[model samples]
Target chain A: MTAVRVIAALALFIPHAALAGEPIGQIKTQTGTVFVERAGASKPVAIGDRVFESDTIVTTSGTVGITFTDNSMMSLGPMSRLKLDQFKFDATTHNGVFNSSLQKGTLSVKSGNIVRQTPEAMHIRTPAALLGVRGTEFVVRADDAS
Target chain B: MTRLRLIAPLASALALSACCGPKDLIVVLPGADGHVGGVIVETGGSKLVLDKAYAGARPGSGASEPVDVSAYEVERVFAKALAARPIPPKTYTLYFVSGGDEIVPESRAELDAMLAEIGDRKAVEVVVTGHTDTMGSSSDNDRLSLERARSVEAQLKDTLAAKGVQSDSVTAVGRGERELLVKTADQTADPRNRRVEITVR
Candidate 1:
């Protein structure tokens, strides 16, 4: 765990704005080694654990699932790495933006309110592809080299 | 040693490629409701739409193929990821009495049943929204609606706490006459319009 934290932190070569506030989501299910890297600190994530935007989730020989505030769902397969880049929503208006990056491994998603009725509200970034999700279910896979 | 390490990974990658399909790929799956939505996968200055169930494409490739990913391939590739999918959210509606914040007797029973369905979940989020008919003044209706929503939100949070929802968040809002379930003129009352909507996730 400690070694992975070091490598993951080093992998974030670019600086980002400080993110702190209410949690934007929570872990709904997890098995084996599931972690959330936030503010340069790495910690294990259990069900019900709050996750904020900009948190990088890493899974090693395990899987993890999360439900965002807007009701979107994301699940990561084994040996996967994902970063929740940006998320903002107004439950009353159902307007928001959802963006994330999958560095490697596999991901499955179900679009939520923020993107269900609106177009171009959700995007998932991968090494070789950028996906515009339109209120649907999809799966993405990427190897490290890609 | 460096040369051997490089060659070893290359050999393993080649062996893995023989069985695995693409280094970067995407497949659209049918939703829980059986609706197969679409995705625009942009790579190498091109965009490909995967609109049909099990449709797939490879990123970074110049040409896009309308590949219909087979069930066997989907299962073989993303079984664990699919299994990790979270349960979808559910919403329930309960009506209130005209000019009163009280929940109708029949709807109370329904609320009880709704509680049973979500009482055991972890990280439960409940949103209770109160709405009313256009019978009364908008300001008065807004206050009544808020009271009605707060009433249920309090009852629910307290009950859920006792029932031991692992971690929960409750939000209450009032839509009042601004949004009516049943369209009506001013000073009109519709039982259907006096209601509360609850969403559990």
Candidate 2:
């Protein structure tokens, strides 16, 4: 939604539903009609479903909670859309990157090892904002429904 | 009671703005321990730093200044999303006898708490890493550590399966004397260093 950056991030996460990357996280909770779109195909999500890079999460009057490999957590609210643009972690060193974009609705995040090991490693994008996390819990709401 | 009633309208206005006013609103929240960090919000050419608990900003307006938000406003606006947060990952340590693979009786129950937590999530992924004190030969320590790890793994693998926790991701590894929790001279025995760590996600 922040136009350039968000659009760019979404572009990377969409269409490639078939280009499934390795599991970067897992769905810890799912309620109602949450769907995951991968490589241009959409499927309903389950509690233990693995989330990968380039995957788009769509919540149609539903909610979802995900925990990343580095222990980062994110929750999406009803009528929300989010994309896992990319994620990489080196368990040995606890260094990693996490990038995601929120197109609409609400998201709550708790930063974990990736951000704690490398403070600039995690970022969340929105229609009008690009957020750089510094090891904290935060929330964001986007009204533009694209 | 009368004064509280008088302040109700102002609270309503805050809730309204919090729910429907900004095109994009970012709020920094305190951690479970009440520690607030910071978030840098970047717009076209401006940036705002929200560094306080309940501090809010609107990126659409390119506002560098943070607006103080009440906890009530945040709860009213973001109750659903906040409620959906996943539990944090956790690590548990099980100590071992310095000379043998026998686990100290007290730390054998590290997995019991984890077992109760597994039901809340779809599955549990476990990594059990074994370590040893430096009092033995490298190969012996390696074997001892691995045996220690296997014993713990045996306790978990079947118990979790019997409980229908749906986890085939349980694994064990031995670090021998390579990764000591407390660094010490060679051939020294330290109870603290002789341990196994279980991580659950």
Candidate 3:
């Protein structure tokens, strides 16, 4: 635990440039195994790890939760591959766009300020169809059997 | 008569299923300042616009019809997101007295409000940027601005700690006269420019 704390402290000091991209959110919770693929390189996702746009998150045997800058939350269940396709928000105006694609498995989303400011700003895509959120919570699950 | 009885039961079952509804994607919004405007759910080239509470299925999905969810259900589905949600970044401006780090009396209320808002959050990130009017030498303004930012940061940190709020990060920077809130000629004393801007997230 001490070592983890040390790493978390050090992480705060790491220049943003070292992270190699614009951070859209951070991993909030992880149970079991989770990996993120960015720039063609895959790495294990830690609790405080930053997630950037275009990053693909795959959970092999557990669940992972991520919170975006807009305070939106996305949780992925086991055997899920979720992509942060696009995220853009204006801090001042609190208006932005949220778009993601769920390749497989179960995922849940809670809308944030971006949707609050304009309800039509969010879009989620699955192999079966595209989803547009109106201002409430919901869940989706996709499997090959369906 | 036997066939009619069987069809009646089947019809009732279908009605019950419709009432239960199909599971649609949920998008929970904030309930602080009243209901958010609404959301649009689109599928298979068709769109369903939900402006009130909840939307169950996409239009033309042939599954369940879209309907409004109660405020109670909205809160329930959004519980997790609400708990993990971060306080949005907000900027508070406090004007300074003439040439010193001391804030103007009128700005104290703004400072207090900012502190109160910060106290409500469990975790926060603060950025205090100090600015100066185009008065005196650039070097002097630079130092004074930084001093002002430090002052605000110190007070903010103390208040937040008292409220059991953890400050993830606190940054103070002095913009000097480079970025003026109001455009002014050199040596012009503008109270609006001589201010500290505190942003809390």
Highest TM-score scorer? 1
Pick out the ten consecutive residues of candidate 1 chain B with the lowest summed lDDT. Answer: B160-169
For each candidate in the order shown, give its overall lDDT on alpha carbons.
0.83, 0.82, 0.70
Question: What does the lDDT read for residue B115 in candidate 3?
Answer: 79
The structural similarity of chain B in model 2 to the true chain B, as TM-score, is: 0.65
What are the runs in model 2 whose C-alpha is more than 4 Å off?
A1-18, B1-21, B119-121, B129-155, B171-190
> Taking the tens digit of each residue's C-alpha lDDT, what string does model 3 give over B1-201?
999999999999999778754333434344455655554556666665555444444333464446655657645543433343334467789876665667888889988888787776544556688888888999988888888888877877777667664555566777688778889999998878888888765
How many pairs in model 3 have backbone atoms within 3 A of each other, for residues 3 or more apart or on separate chains, i.e. clashes? 5
For B25-85, candidate 2 gives per-residue lDDT tens digits of 8889989978777899888878788888988887765456888888997898789999888
Every model's DockQ, to 2 decimals?
A: 0.48, 0.42, 0.18
Better of 2 and 3 by DockQ: 2
Q: Lowest lDDT 10-mer window, candidate 3 chain A?
A: A137-146
Q: What are the iRMS values of all candidates?
A: 1.9, 2.8, 6.0
Question: Per-residue lDDT tens digits of candidate 1, residues A1-146?
Answer: 99999988876743443457678888888989899999989999898888898899999999999988888899999999999999988765567899999999999999887886577699999988899988589899987776
Candidate 3 Cα outliers beyond 4 Å, as residue runs:
A1-19, A60-63, A71-80, A90-96, A105-119, A132-146, B1-24, B27-32, B58-64, B68-124, B127-201
| Tens digit per residue, CA lDDT, model 2, A96-135 | 8999999899999999878878886899988877899996
- TM-score, each model? 0.82, 0.77, 0.54
- The worst-scoring run of ten residues by lDDT in candidate 3 chain B lies at B78-87
